[model samples]
Each structure stands twice: as structure tokens, then as C-alpha cells.
Target chain A: MSDIVTAAMLVIGDEILSGRTKDRNIGHLAEMMTAIGIDLKEVRIVADDEDAIVEALNAIRARYTYVFTTGGIGPTHDDITADAVAKAFGLPCEHDERAYAMLAENYAERGMDFTEARKRMARMPRGAVHIDNPVSIAPGFRIENVHVMAGVPSIFQAMLDNVVPGLKTGTRLISVSIHCPAGEGTIGGPLGEIQKQHPDTIIGSYPKYLDGKFWTELVVRARTPEALAPAEEAVRQMVARLTDSAAAI
Target chain B: MSDIVTAAMLVIGDEILSGRTKDRNIGHLAEMMTAIGIDLKEVRIVADDEDAIVEALNAIRARYTYVFTTGGIGPTHDDITADAVAKAFGLPCEHDERAYAMLAENYAERGMDFTEARKRMARMPRGAVHIDNPVSIAPGFRIENVHVMAGVPSIFQAMLDNVVPGLKTGTRLISVSIHCPAGEGTIGGPLGEIQKQHPDTIIGSYPKYLDGKFWTELVVRARTPEALAPAEEAVRQMVARLTDSAAAI
Candidate 1:
């Protein structure tokens, strides 16, 4: 397996930016990427404008191993993700026959006419492969490294379930958390030194305020359990020593 | 008032990227920005790495009217946002006397030692103005167009309340929402025409799946009520016409 497989998420929507909608997709994708050993390196949320979508899509897709985008895929004027992605890749976007057939059949089965607007869902960048959406028949597409999906959380998740199995994964990261009764103020100095000593591990100190008192949680992550254990132990010892000294004082 | 005021949010943290923390600040800030007539144009969530922070901060602050960053202001080795913002502005990052006085007094009042680690919370870019935090004594700072705030949701909100008064606002946006019993596929064609007819207003169609049926909510927004009213009425008439025709068939 690769040592690190990285991904970035692009949320394309006006509702989210306008505060009319709260995004549930970013957290879902972030957690999904983490569990599958892909580091979600960055996330960019842009509006539904084609120019903004093309610009952001081009920027992040060039840097990350994979880019997942949500929103702007429905059959509406604002649903311009397909065209924007095609522009980003410099490919001609047209109605894919397979996608057309799928959506056509779905609407037909429901005794509905697959209008020109419904057929718009079938459009994709040339040479793109359809990502199956069991929730709704309108398929998302994969053009190069970018996986474009719907913005709705349920459909996005359903599409992701179909996409995850095919991705190149990295070595699973091992994480250990140590709770500190003391605040980062009391332990941050020594914790920095421990981080320096354990160069292979990532040590993160998160502060939490509860019941009018502040405390810190230290999480150490490494590629292997062997690499994680020592850093975890060092953090535990540092918290114990500092909290003990603070209590004594 | 300005016709448009745009802002971007940069979230600095590994915890958010790693899926250990779900971001509440983005939604909170987005809603707040919209309410205050500022367009939240884009949002970028980056890691705690200084280079990443500096790059993203520079990219966004140069484009938007203002840039707000959340996270990495705490007293820890991983808290690198202040230094990163300073680097982006090519300024010296050192202990701000006012922030130092505020945090030191808070620690003293709480019967805690203001250690070197605690003092680290007082650091800010040179010539930055401190944004007051009522939830915590450690202040967030604003240098140039960038406002660096805390990761904790409560502290971030409190600091935002203090920062908003100083910002330049635009004309307040007027929004009208109309629900459609039909899906976007059924109403999308005429809706697109309505959007083209009202170029001054932004028409957004949001699809929702409830009770095994897909419906849409159309929201029209414009800077003035006059611009918004006509677009909203057009959308309402379009949805009514489409759903009625669909029902007749």
C-alpha cells in the first residue's frame, strides 16, 4: 500500500454559501476518507457559478490524489457542475448515452416523461465513467481524478459507498488519545518537546472547556502501532507530571 | 453601503481534516455573514501546517473583502495560525502587550500560573488589533483583512460578535422561498427560463426527498425587494404551471 493517499473535497453550492443550507456532506466525506486511509488534505466550498467551480476544481484536483465534489448536479439551471467540470478538464460535455438510458428508464418506470430537463442529468465530461447512484438514477461521474456527486447527503453517501471500494488506499493510521485534566497552558511546553522527539508521529493537542474549566486532549497518530505507542506514552507521562506539579503548586 | 461585500473563511486544523472534529464554525459564520449583508464567497479548510495556512490565507485575503480564520489560536505546539498569518503579511509575530495583559490577568484571577505556554496565547502579528473573546480571555487578532479566531465554537462566535461591528457591510439581501410539489426534473426547464428572465436575482433550486417523493424549494435572492419580488413571483407561477400540467397528465 502507498504510505499516504490524499484527497480533497469541493462543495459546490449557493445555498451553503448563502446560509440557506447547512452542509452535511463535508463532515461525511471527511470521516469517510479518514476511515479508508485517505488523508482528506483540504476542502473548498464554492458557489454554483461555473467559473468559480472550474477555477476551484482545477486548483485542488491538480494537487490532491483524488478530488470529490458534491452539489450542482441536479436538473436545474444552477446545476452546472457537469459543465464546469468539463471546462476544468478542457473536455466537451455532452449527454452520455448510458446515463441517458438509466435516467430515461427510471422516469419511464414511474410513468413520467423524461423531459429535456431530466435528460440534462445525463450530461458529463467526455470520457467520464458513471458512478452508480442506487438512491436516485441520475449517476455521478468520474472525470480524471475528480468524483462528482450530488449534494444531498443521502445520495452523496450512497454514491460514496459505490466509489470507495475502487480507490487506492494508504496504510491505516494508528491513533491513541490521552486525556489531560490540565489545560494546554500547563502541558504545552513539554508536549512540544515530546513532539520534537517523536518526529514520525503527529501529536495534536485539543483544548476543551467544560463546567467552567478548561482541559486538553492529546491525540497521537502514526502509520503503525509501534510508531504510535511511544508518542502516546510520552504524552501520557507529560500530562501526568505537569498536572501533578500544578496540583502541588 | 457597498453593493457587495465578500468574505472567505479559512479553517486551520488537523482535527477537522482528520474527522476528529466536526466544524460548527463554518455554518455559524456563513449564517452570520449572510445576515449582515456580507457574501461568504468561499471557504477553505486547511491543515495546521504553517505553509498551508500562509498559502491559503494569502490566496483568499487577496481576493475577498475580508477573510476570517478559525482554529489554531490556542497555546500548543500545533497552534501555528498566528505565525502563519504574520508570515502571509510579512510581519513579525510576537507577544502583543494588550493580549498578554488580558490573558495574564485572567489566569491570575483564576489562581493559575501564567506559564510560558499560557503566554504563547498572547502572540499576534505586529500591528494587529485584538478581537475580544468574552468566552475566553485569550484574544483573536485582525491584521489587514484577515481575522484569526479560535477553533472552539463558543469562543469563535463570541470573537465574531466583536469583529462584525467593525466590518464594512453591503446592501441587505432580500430572500423569498417557494416550495414546489414537483421535482427539479419536472420544473427545471421553465425555471431556467425564469432565472434568465430575472438576471438581477439569484434563483436557487434545492431538492429534498421526503416520504419517498422528491420535491424542490426555490429560493430567489436580490439586493433589493423590487428585484426579488418579480423573480419570486415568476418562480411561483412556473412551479404552479408545471405541477398542474404534470397532474393533468
Candidate 2:
């Protein structure tokens, strides 16, 4: 936990809050962050209002090593993310000329009119770095440690792929999951004891009620394989004991 | 906005943050809250750590009219929501006889022993109101305005159904979506002007790239039909103009 590189996400969209659109970025980001060394500590989903965006940005940016915000960076009236980011950082927002050219070229190639609303996508806070948009020409921006991204899942994933490989992350946490046919109540005490014994490993118990049978899973996570091995063995042995007794019953 | 009943959600689970499980509660709760006239303003997903849970609870409870927390209330080691809620409220967490009796009866009917881990589900904050769980025997609790429910989708939905009908709510916000075959850039300017004109209605522009074609949607929302009707008409006219222009091209 001491050396774990922590990150947080801010998901901004009215559609998500209204249940009109289910979020896809959170799950994809979580999986990718876990595969790398970053510990995704928290996620906050807020509406498109500027105050809500600023408050969430300030809170998440201050707490974690990195903050990735998705949504409201589009060519529309409600796309207030860039303006909110500028307000949060006390900086002026302006159109980045380079991003403008890139977007203009993209539109030209597609035989579409590059209107003023499309130009709005180029705006970002002062001292911001452009994050590439592989799927679209409208680039996401990075101010300090906060990475702004598109709300659309494909564009968000592309921006994340462009950003994550370059970040400073810690040791990738190794995870091992044990699928146990035993119930949580039958195995909870021993699992807790095992978790306490291995303080470095994070042990989680997940219960599933499937086919009218209650089964539980024990997952162990550690910074290194060496740390994960012992805790995993403990869980396997405990599950074996419980499974044998339950079979006898 | 004056009478809007605002709500926030805290999803407490390591499994969601770790990407082992994709959260299904937020969308379900959001849709249900919208149906009953509550604006789900903010959502926070935190790990099973007590400090994180307590911090999210304190912040959201002070700001929102209601807080609904899902997960971390099971019969497992990581099921620490009850204790965390108790710590946040400065209350004693004790076994409720009513909950214990209900769970005991349910387990007896299934011919299973009510073990210690099972009993942990009965522990709730002092002076908490028990929210019935139709799927499982363990009851969720409501302390003040923060409703603590199970992470499982079915149980969470059942608890929400039992709890939401009793709460005082405002006028349900009505929404209308206009699917425009045109792009966001074509409609952004006029939409912003219309939004400025009709300050009561919230218009959101969502762009989509579907089936290799570019399309956008304008969603209009207002608390009353009287407020929404004119704004919806304006969007329809705007989209009609955009479609004509694109056709001419």
C-alpha cells in the first residue's frame, strides 16, 4: 500500500446520472489501471454543471497521483469540461492552434464543414498538453496531472491508451483468485485469519448465489508474486478443508 | 431547481474498483430515482477501506438530500459497511433482534444453521430503520437519509423499491430526446441560443458515431411539461433546418 501509485477518475455527464446512458469507461479504465501499476483508488461521477465538475476535479486531483476525467469535452453547448478545468486551476482557457489545425484537417478529409462548435473542442486550460485522440481528431488535454478525455467509450479508451504508457507507475499488483464452492459463512472466519496473517496481501471474499447454490470466491492481491503466493496457498488449503467437510454433510 | 430533491450515491466495494465486478446498481438506482422525482446529482465509488467509506459518507450526507450506498454489507470480512456507517455517525453498531429473528427464521426454513458470519448481517447502526430485503433475509438499514443496501443487483433493487415509495419527492423531471442525423457542430450554436432563451429547460447534445455514420441527439429535460414543450419544439425546428442543409450538400 505504501508504494502503490494511486489514481482516481471523474466521470462527467448528465446522461450517466439520468440513467439514459450507462457508463462503459469506468470498467475499461479500472481493468487497464489494475493491469499496470496504478491503484485506482476512487471514482466520482458528476453532472455537466461547471460547479459540480470543478468540485469533483479539485477533490480528486488533490488526493490521487493522477486524475482522469471523461465527458463534456465535445462540440456542444453543454460541453463545459474545458472551461471547468480552467476555473478549477485558476487559468485562462484558449484554443490550442495545433489542435485546431489537426481537427480542421480531419474535417476537411471527411468533406465536413469545420464549424465554430467543432473548433470549441480545441480549447483547454493554460499550460495544457494535448492528448492524442486516435479515433477522432478532437484531442483531449492534460493539465498538470489531470487527463481530460471524451465521454464516448471508444475515444476515451483511445485517449487512455495514449496517456497511460507514459505515466510513472509502481509495481504491478499480482492477483490470484480461488473459486470455492463453499459459502461465505462457512469460510469467513478462516479467511479473515488468513488475511490478518498476511498483512501485505489484500484478501476479498465474494459470494455468488447461482443455481440455488451459494458459492464464494477468495481473491488475493499483492505487489509481487512472492507476496501473493503464500496468501493464495492459505486460501486454497482453507477451501479444501471446507469443501471436504461440506461433502461429508 | 428550487424544489428538486437531490440525492447522491456511494458505491462501497473493492470488487467494483478492482474491475472484478462491473457495478449494476448506479444505473438501476438512477433510473428509479428519476422515475420518483429525485435528482441523483453525484455518485462516488470507494473501496472497502473504512476511512474512504467514512469520508465519502460525511461529504455527501452534508450536501445531498439523500444518500444511497450499495455494497459492503454482506456476511464476509470485507463487508464492513455497517461498522463504517456507525463510525461515520458516531453511533453504536449492535445486533438488532428483529433482523436476527427474521434472518434466523429464513435460514431455518432452508434447513441451514445461522452461523456467526450470518449474524454479522444483523449488525446495524443504532436507531437505524430496517429496509426489507425480499430476495435475502438480511435487512438493509437507513440512518438519517443515508440508505445502506446490498451490492447484489436483485437485493439492491428490492430494497430500493421498498424504500423509495415512502420518501418525500419533488415533481418528476420529464425528458425528450430528438435523434438528429446531423452532427453536433451543425447544431451547437442554435442549441446554445435556445438553451439561453429557455433557461428552465436543460438541453444536452450527445454525438454518436454509429454504423460508420455520424449522428447527434438533443435531449431536453424539464421538471414540468409546460417548461419542456416550447424547448422541445425549438429543438425540432433546429434539427429540421440542419437536416435540410445537409441534404442540400
Candidate 3:
């Protein structure tokens, strides 16, 4: 028996859509999820509107094992992710004492007022568990399987550390790369057959055009490294044959 | 009357989800769409699976005026975007004579065979119009409101240039920015009220933490510069009042 855990990231922000901010959270989450053996199946970026965020959260969280959302958790009118997450689950949001205490202490230490806007950071959906934030005192939270994290890279990454250890691991994928100088047209037919045979595995062909010449990087992936040997051999042999035929012609 | 046009982008690739390749297409599309007055509303990254592509295409194309897809139109077994597009629209795909001629001649000039894999690039959904590719002979195609382009950055950018000119123009938004070294908690309440007053305009507050200090940049956006005078004055006055009160306290 095997377990495969899948995840999806919902990036909530108007800045990202407007081209004002380049997203670092999705790529970072992609790399981190892959490293931890969780398959990141999909990523959707929506504007910082409440209904949009709520709709996206409901759709993606239902499809994947875990859902992580970045952005719109800060202390501003634009930061509406928390409210959206609450509305998505039909849960009432209230001031969380632990989060309030943490933020109040941080604000006191900095000799700043714990203003009403700052208080917004302390609100959490009912029955949700709080996530730790090492960067700032304001914390993210977890409701069901969905984890809400800060949009800022430093805080989001810090909060992710808290969420990762609790997730179940799956079979780590093994990758085999073959750099073929042959264009995709020369290899596409045989490659399709290989993919059909290894239906359980993932075969991806990335075409590259550099140095005024075209080439392809063939990537074969599966759960087990030991099982990839034969498939890898098939790909290598196929590429070799294709390259030779092109030369002869 | 404000001609408001909205668009969405579908990034088709397994590489992006696997973190093997960071997406450049989304950011580039975001920048271009924003500059040309088309509001880039939603962006989704999906794997190269046909069902996933079709689902994403149908969902997004129905919501926005235009939908632009990048990747999966290449000379490889994994390149199935054309087939997916055809399935989504219930149209037959065929080898476009114009696309075939362009690719065949390009390959002939390079002394390469017009292999079946290369021929795959010429296939388009029925009734689709071709978009030119200045870098390579493989052309992108437009069917209904959806435009499908190559995943490679250079080629994707080239195809985008051709598709963008044909899109409907909207009332270009005018933006006004004011940087205040006040925490969002100190200004979010007032800003929300300001936003309520100018319901026609879009107000975004971006918070920043620099040099051990808190600051925020308030951005006001509206279609007409003349109409923005009152809303902008109110925002400037609010920020000034908030700044003054904090200083007095």
C-alpha cells in the first residue's frame, strides 16, 4: 500500500495580479513541498477580494490534502485573507487571546501602540489552531487542513516550518534526466510509446533553444529509484537510436 | 464610459508545479496586461494533463474576456495543449497548411528533416487563427477567446505581442501613491473608511518593514485622472491627519 499526499497553494493578493509584486511564495512552496514528498498539484492566484479568496479556498482545499494560502493576512484593509478563510468554512472569527497576547507583548517591546489595525492580526476562525511565526509576533493559523500563512517571504517561510512537520510523507519521486541533442520531432513517436508503457511514471520533455541550436531534456520520474533503471535504459537507448538515424539520413 | 476588459492566464506545465522551472510567463503577462489596460484577473498553473488543461481553460475562459495559455505546444509527446484545446471547444484539430509550410521551410533551411514530431507543432484546433512566432516557425493559435502559445519564454513573449494588439482596450487606470512611515494598524481603519467613500476607485495599502521601522505605501487607482482629484485629496488628508495624531500622542 502507498500513500500520496497532494497540496495546493492559494496566493491571495491584488499586488501579484497587478504586476506590482513578483511572487516568491509559490516557487518556494513548490520546492519545499517536493522536497518533503508532498505533491503540489495546483496553484491559483486571485485578487485581494473576500469572495474571490473564499471561492478559491473552498475549491482548492476540497481537492487537495493540504491547502496553503499566502498574502492578505497583514494589518490593513487590503489584508482580507483571514476573513475570507473564515467565511469559506462558515466559521465565526474572533479575537484569539494567545495571538493577542503575543502581539501585545511585541508591540509593547517596540514602544508602539497596539492599535485596532494591529488587533486585526489576532482574529482567528473558530476551532482553528494557531501557527507560530518567528519573524513577527502576529501568527498564522490552521483550520481543518488549510494553513494560512503570511504573504511576506520571511514570515511565510517561518510559518511553513511549523506546518511541515505535521504533514504525512509520501513516496519520494526519483528523477532521470537525459540530454538529447535530437529535436523533439525525432524522438516524439518513440517517446509516446515509452510513456504509454510506463503509465505509472511521469515523462516530461522540455525543449531548449540556446547557442542558436535546439535540444531537448527528457525527464523520467517515478516513486522508486530501483524501478527506474529499466525505464531509464529504454529512454537512453531510444535517444541513441534517434540521434544515429538522423546522422545517417 | 470605462471600457473595462479582464483577462486570465493559464500556465500549462508540470515543471512549474515540480519546481524544476520557475515561471517567467506569468510575471511577463502580468506586466504587459497591466500596461495595456487589460486587468489580468486570475492566474492558474496546471500540469500537462489533458483533463487539467481542459478544465482550467473552460473555467477561466468563461469568466474573463480573454484567456492566454502558455506552454505545452511543442514538438514532444508531452506537448498536448493543442489536443486539449480542441477537446475543450468540441472542435477537430488539423495540420494548418500555413503553419506546416512555415515550419517545413525553417527546418529545410537548417538542414533538418520535417519529422512527425516537428509536424505536431503545426496542429491547431478547427477554426483557429494562427499567431506568428518571430523566433521559431511554430506558431501559436487563437480559438474563440483563448490564445495558446509556446511555454518557452522567448517564444511565448513573441506570440503575446501579436495577440495583445487585437485585444479590446479599456479605460487606462491612473494611480496615485503616497508613502507614509505609519504602521498599517495606525491607518487601516481610516483607509477602509476612505475606500468606502470612493467606492468607484480602488485603494491598496502595501506595508513595508525597513531599517527597523514600519511604513506603508497607499496606492489610489481610478480610471480618470480628473475624477481622482477629490478621492486623492481625501486620502492625502487622511494620511496627514493620522500622521499628525500619532505624532501628537
Best by lDDT: 1
For all candidates, state DockQ relative to the true structure. 0.74, 0.67, 0.64
Q: Candidate 3, which segments miss by more than 4 Å at Cα?
A: A239-249, B210-213, B237-249
- Point out the worst 10-residue segment of candidate 3 chain A by lDDT: A240-249
Looking at model 1 chain A, report the run of 10 residues with the lowest lDDT sum: A240-249
Task: Tell me the spans in candidate 1 whose CA falls farther than 4 Å from its real position.
Answer: A242-249, B243-249
Task: Estimate, for each residue in B1-249, the C-alpha lDDT of model 3 and write its tens digit.
Answer: 548899999999998999888888888898888888889999999999899999989999999999999999997888999999999999998999989999999888878778888899999998899999988778999999999998989889989998888889787777888877787777887888888888888999887766656678888988888668778999899877876776512
Q: In terms of TM-score, which candidate is stronger, 1 or 3?
A: 1
Backbone clashes in model 2, listed as residue pairs: none
State the TM-score for model 3: 0.94
Candidate 2 yields a Cα-based lDDT of: 0.90
Residue range B34-103, candidate 2, lDDT tens digits: 8888999999999999999999999999999999999999888889999999999999999989998998
DockQ ranking of the models: 1, 2, 3
- Candidate 1's DockQ is 0.74
Colliding residue pairs in candidate 3: A185-B117
What CAPRI grade goes to candidate 3? medium
Tens-digit per-residue lDDT, A46-165, candidate 2: 999999999889988998999999999998899999999999999999999899899899888878778888899989997899999877778999999999999988889989999987
Error of 2 at A86 (Å): 0.9
Better of 1 and 3 by DockQ: 1
Model 2 chain B lDDT-worst window of ten: B240-249
